[model samples]
Target: MISATLGIEIERGVRKLLDEAGTSWPSELKVLVDRPAHPDHGEYSTNVSMLLAKTLRKSPMEIANKLKSELEHAKIAEGIFSKIEAVAPGFLNFAIDWNVWLNRHREYSAYQGETEKGKVVIEHTSINPNKSAHIGHLRNSCIGDTLARLLSRAGREVEIHNYIDDLGNQLADTVVGILHTKTEGEHVRFGDFCWDTYAKVNKVYKGSPELQEERTRVLHELEEGTSSTAWIGRLTAEKIVREQLHEMKAFGIGYDVLVWESRIVAEGLWEAAFEHLQATGAFYKVEEGKLAGCWVLRHGGEGSGEAEGTPSPDPEAHQADKVLVRSNGILTYTAKDIAYHLWKFGLLSQDFTYMPFADGVWSTDSQGQAMPFGRGETVINVIDYRQEYPQAMVKLALEALGYKEQAARLLHVSYGVVSLSPETAESLGVDTSAGKGSYAMSGRQGVGIKVAELLQVMEESIESKRSRQEGLSSREIAAAAIRYYLLKYHLQTEVVFDLRQATEVSGNSGVYLLYAYARAGSVLEKAGAGQKGSGKALMEPPVPSFDGGALEPPERQLLKQIAYWTETMDAAVRQLAPNLICSYAFELSLLFNNFYGACPILKGPDDRVELRVWLTWKFRETLGKALDVLGLPAPDRM
Candidate 1:
């Protein structure tokens, strides 16, 4: 909030300087405020003067000086900035008045982000309804759930969707295995049984052409939605999807609606999409080639979206055409996805019927009451980076269909894959000698750690550590550890799953944050809760005035960290990066611990003690808010 406030003031000051000189400026001027690394320079610095130097034909230092003078004389700058200086080359540095900074905390202790108009639909954790979820799926769910929380907390209406690819090849394989090879017997967890059956079917398909033919047959029946085989596939997909939902719920992930891939096909959504694609010339028939009789959507390279019948310079260029509908009349996943996204942006006139799946959850049904879903102004698909090309094609389809604005609003929030660490892989009985870095899990090989299995290990590890504290349950600890581990890495960074590292309480982990929160609570408890309703009185200004002179070096550093809470959140939301919040929380925790060691809160001088208690309260509130945004539960004691 300080950054936003300063940004506005700085822009106004620059405009005033230009107005005084009677000089023209760019219509759109971007002013950025960054916290300086060293305290001596200033609390915040800007390089806008340098950015404008070349355009204005003036020396950078001259522009910075003029801007600084204007800022000093500005009416809004009174009592806000203690000092404004022009540093070398062209940097405008500002030091906030200590009293003013404290006053901001008192004035707005609970800052909610400004509300925005329109809805955002985020589709994530779209696992195939075939087997149990693995660590890879957990990464998708955690990232997506945190993103939803961040956007919603920032005052954006967000709808979380979990797409169930029930009619895909994975489920088809499971169905084939169940109908042909497996015995008719009851299983405790149907998803677990399907997991093994899925792997076995993949192996059989590799060796037996006859079994592969059966798999293809099962796929067709599943798509047609008729016969016993289709009925079995539906039942199996529903069962597996339920298990996946349960696993995600354990991690505090929930969905606003379930978009079934089968329903997208059954309701003729893809048929409508195909008609639109043909109408827009988004795809063409490949005549007299290897892909003859197939409808292909152009991806990249030559002969792509040129004259319809234009011959490629190289016949090999035809490979760029991704087959949408095969000669055999089978629709590819990309084809259905185009339809799904079209429906997402409300471009399609049709909509799916919805039924209550759970208390605040809805699922698509053939004959059910309709409800408001989809029709989003923006759509974000939180999928792994491996599917980048597929997602790109979906956007391309939108653009080719003349929905250019809708295409712009469609974002693929891609992240790197979650792989097994060499040690963890070996621990899982997987041979790591063949691989050098992290080993990517193969579902067909049945070699990935299930979400359930990982949770079990994390819960057991936390239970062992709970001998020292009773503030958090084993389940709470497990959720915190898993969520933190998955979110701590940058979006492009691949997470190498390791149980030991995830469960560790020391260093940038969720467990560390928990202990930090608990420490603040313990300090507040020792301070005797600070006079009832005196909570607001603890803040500087108008209530119990804070003695700015009593603040020590560590206390100032702590306040600086606390001041960045909203600024950090704004950046995280803008960049769609949840790891920013994680990093901020970790850094804030370190600063608080340092401050705790350097400044005694309870036993210090009376004035310093009261000031430190207020600082403690501020830190606790800020850290707790960040944890909530990260979807990590805060524990009172540890």
Candidate 2:
């Protein structure tokens, strides 16, 4: 907010200078105001003069001096800045008048201005309904859920969809294993039972071509939607989905809708999409050779140099065109995805029937009521980086059918895979004697950490070390620790999970932030400033007058950080990056801690106590909002 005010005044001053010289302002130039690294430079500084040197044909220092002189006498700048300085080498610095700012500045509120239009559909946690969810799946869920919260905070109508691929090969393999093989152990959940069965079936298929053919047969029956095998597949998928949702709820993740792949096929959405693509002349059939009888989409003269009517010389070569349908008349995963996206953007002629799945949640079914679920102006899919090719193909299909605007609005938020650190792998009973620094997770090999087991282990660890005086339960702390740990890294960086580092009570962790919030609450309660039955002090409108004349250095720094909350939130929403919020919250906590150690709130001098108390209240309010956006619980005491 401060930056916006400074940028306007600087631009007006620069324009006045340009008007006198008959100079037209450059349309592409933007004014950027930032906090300087040293306190001696003033509160905020701008280099607009340096940016205008080439256009004005003058030295930067001369322009800076003239602009500074023009700004000093401006009516709008009279009450805002105590001083405006022009330093060496073309830089303009401004020291704020704290008395005017504290009395007039608006408190932080979620932006509900011109940018908050249209509905956003975020599809995430689209795990295949075959086995239990692993640690990597947790990362995808955490990222997606936090994004939904952040967008909603910015006043966007957001809907979340969890796509379930029940008709895929993974579920087919799991069904064949469950019906044909015999297991040896007792299981508590159906998903856990399928985990072992899936591994066993893959092992047997390595040597037997007969089992591979049977797997293909199962896939066809599952698509037909009338056979006994299809019935078993439906039962299997629904059971696993229930278990997955249960685990996700423990970590504060929920969905508004569950879109099953079978419903899309049964409703003929894929058939409509196929016809639409064929009419555009980009989708065709391979007449002969290795890709004979298969429907393919050419890559717009890119990739392997095989033409539409030509036969490939090498059967094992990477094909230039993507096959949407195989010779046996079955749709590929990419083909189904193309159809789903068309419905998401409301380009398809058909829609799904919805039924209540849980409290305030809906699911697509063959027989239910019609509802308004799709037709999102913007769509974001949170899949891993490995699916980049398939995601691109989906976009290409949209463009081929002349839905170019929807194609441009489609976003693929790709992230890296998760691995286990050496110490964590050893704790999970994996063989770390090989001395590898990181171990990748694999479901086929049964070498991964399950979501349910991880939560239980983390909760037990927190309980063992927590003091009785702490006002939060172990489960609450565990959720905060895990969610923050997964979101602290950059989206594209490979996460190597370590339990010890995530649960630390000091240094840049969720526990540290929680402790700082509780400490402020404790101070307010002791001074009788807290309202009855509330964790925070009474925050009335039009901030109360305080002793700004006696402000200490630490107090000034804390106030600056508190004032940047709205700017930080705007940047996070524009970039669609949650790590920026994590960084801001951590730095804010550190500044508050510094002020706590240096200045007293309850035991301060009589004239300064009111200012210090108001500062602490603002810090708590700002930090609490940030915690909500990041999907971390903020307890008053912990």
Per-candidate clashes come to 0, 0
Best by TM-score: 1
lDDT (tens digit, per residue) of candidate 2 on 438-478: 99887777778888878777788788877775778888888
Model 2 quality (TM-score): 0.92
- What lDDT is obtained when candidate 1 is compared to the true structure? 0.83
Error in Å for residue 73 of model 2 = 4.6
Distance from true position, residue 342, model 2, in Å? 1.1
Candidate 1, backbone clash total: 0
Score each candidate by Cα lDDT.
0.83, 0.83
Q: Which tens-of-lDDT digit does each residue in 1-638 have in candidate 1?
A: 66777889988888776777677677676898998888777678999998888767799899999887777777444466778889988998887667776766655345577465689999999999998889899999999999999989888899999998877889988998887676344646788788888888888788788988887888899889988999998898888888888988888899999999889988888888888888655477777667777887777422355765454445466687677888788888998999999999987877899888874779999988788899998898999999998998898888888888999999889899988889888887888888777887889988888988788888888888776757878888888889999999999999888767877878988988888988987888778755336333222212235656456789888887887788888889888999999999999999999999988888856666777887888888889899999888777767
Cα error, residue 166 of model 1, in Å, equals: 0.8
